[model samples]
Target: MSRVSRRRFLEDSLIAAAIAATWAPSRAESEGSLGRKVGPNERINIAVLGVHGRGLDHVKSFAKMKDVAVVAIVDPDSNCFEKAVKAVEELGKPTPKTVQDLRRILDDKDIDAVSIATPNHWHALAAIWAMQAGKDVYVEKPVSHNVLEGRRMVEAARKYKRICQTGTQIRSAVGSREAIKFIHEGGIGTVYLARGLCYKRRDSIGKLPDGPVPQGVDYDIWLGPAPKRPFNPNRFHYNWHWNWDYGNGDIGNQGIHQMDVARWALKKNKLPNSVISLGGRFGYEDDGQTPNTQLAFMDYGDAQLIFEVRGLPTPDLLGVKIGNIIYGSEGYVAFTSYSTAVVFDSKGQKVKEFDGGGDHYRNFIDAMRSRKESDLTADIEEGHLSSALCHIANISYRLGSPQPFNPRTKAFGDDKEAYETIGRFEKHLAENGINLNEATYRLGPKLVLDPEKESFVGSAEANALLTREYRKPFVVPDKV
Candidate 1:
């Protein structure tokens, strides 16, 4: 990975970035066909992994596509399989096989692709193994558990020549594509900044004692790659998003969507030159270790991106919450929802609007038949890079401490907007009756990062976090 140059990384990844922002499909990408042609009437056999929350969506969505079949459902919890099988049946699709482990599904030569909605820890590994088993893949957003895993996921897709898609469905939304097109066409003038706002409230998880594993659940398989531990409700199901071992916190949970949009608007391929975060899990005490409130600023040289996450109950900022606020010199665009974009002028008057409709699943199916990775919205690289930002932000927060920073010099110097943002964040918390001792609050060091090498400069602690040690058999191989 160190041998990979910045230019090469940017050049290789720019296609996805451009496609995401401008909806401009290259000639080669538009015309290329999947190595093996699947006639219009041919069927694409897919298996949905991790059949719980997001996984159920995969089962139903695939079941509706013409000539696409949900051949199997995989999950460590038998209860999840039951629910997914019911979902498939309710959709009028033939009942698919249900399995408690992914290995059996991977062995079936008939499977064409795997729709993976597994836990964050399982995402990269499952996708890689599926591709290794001679199948294409449609992985959910933040495609890796760690930065290193993301890079490896991209390598596996390319090395195996498999068609892979990321589940950042906004890329398929007509409104989002049109909005980005507008931004790039001078509608928004010179875009220099983007603010991703996630202001939803999360109540305390309240500590729970480690409990016995539920019957019919392959707990060992569920814990694959993650550290060995007793099963607790807080660490399972939707709650996993708040646990660092299984999730990337709210920023990685719902925040990745906005982060992807911010990067797309800037056409950023390589990562930011520097990053810093200040915040913590305030409001209440619980089993959740990840911060409930966070402010992360990424300096991308010419421009900057700011992401704010507030889990305590709060009102929207400038009528925007859990959405993206892209600021340009002349105007701005607010992605209000999955399918709606509202553009505003410098005077705060709404200028243009766009509505959305498109199926990311259908996009993948079309690309699978064409055999061109570009035809699909959110290719694997797109997912990896966007997901990497989440991991990067987490590292900064994990190693944070109150420190001075300068937005002008792009390093630690006199304080500026970064300080202002944190100041406002603190004020908001206080307004909501949450107060910190101030001293315990951490502000990350203004660590310099080399985009080309994808590592921190002169910081062994930060560099070591780029990857992680994997357990045997479940390990994410360095070479993919």
Candidate 2:
């Protein structure tokens, strides 16, 4: 067997053992009594997981809802509990019980749902566990560490008959809804391509030596699905977004919002037929593992999606710094923010604009009450599809080799848009003082995928990347 295949075999064996030893569906799980229906007048009790950053938003959003209660705050970092508690108490709501580990609250009959804003690595396992425990879920974007875990989350949601929502809150926005409607109505005639941009500047997380775990931090639980390693400030808290072990870089981080919008504009629900990615961590070197400036091209036969992630400073495209520009034959739509978009004709003339917002939390609560997955604006299936796009692109990039920059190569075969995008990417790097003559970028192979199977075609190496090696007791089961 090839080295990659052999390694995958060992990993799969270990994962199977872990799942068999650690996981089993109980009678309560089978009957789905871990969750209780919330009456119209009754409150929906919730636990906000990973209350360090985004989880705090969940606490504040839910604490203000008349029919929702922030019953508990969960995080591996106990230090974050104070701020979360303060936010709830300041809102005139009762102080929420704080816990460091999510597993501690899984069996709580009072907690009806879990808003998972944990790190990317923990998203799938957390959501699956909550679903098994009969709790509904509102997991953040790029909902899994890898592609297979996402499908597992979907299966668990289906089996448990849970009201699971993706945290792509843009789907709940009034403006986004109207804009999508306009596209579907042919406001942008014959849409063929979508360009998602993530031009937000990211500073380097400077090198830091291995250090003692912070006080009050349940380090082991924090490392849950991720491999155990000595603590480093660069790989903790917010900085973990750049690490491959715990995060999916900016593409899966801030870029996922735009990526989802791009895919939504195309109205494609399945994975792309093929994908290619090329870029590197340019400008400055640090402990960061993922690329700072990257370009991914996903081919969907008749339509195409191009996503750009520029971590260094750069100019906006069509007045958007971190948004989507969906190109149609007659006109195009440009998203300015999560809840706002502008439609322009072929001549760049302003046609229409959509500007408004809606409450994603409220939408989730409504679906939970109705006990219908169809009521959700961004259901688990939608989340899995979009999150899978990011994973496949990353998988291609990971299997790539360093190649010198070349603008004239027909790597994209006759796709002019792809070539033009590469030109722009080169210029963007040059403007940021990247010397192309000396530095080389990782040019990933164009990987063909069987969308129906959700696996790569004839590439065991790529298929192995669809999932990851699991840590015991925290494994995302093969059978949900």
Best of the candidates, lDDT: 2
My TM-score estimates for the predictions, one after another, are 0.89, 0.94
Best by TM-score: 2
Error of 1 at 318 (Å): 1.9
**lDDT by residue for model 1 (288-384), tens:** 9898989888999788899999988777876788889888999889988877889999999998999977999999998888888889889999888
Colliding pairs, model 2: none
Error of 1 at 120 (Å): 0.4
Would you give me the overall lDDT of model 1? 0.82
The CA lDDT of each predicted structure is 0.82, 0.90
- Work out how many backbone clashes candidate 2 has: 0
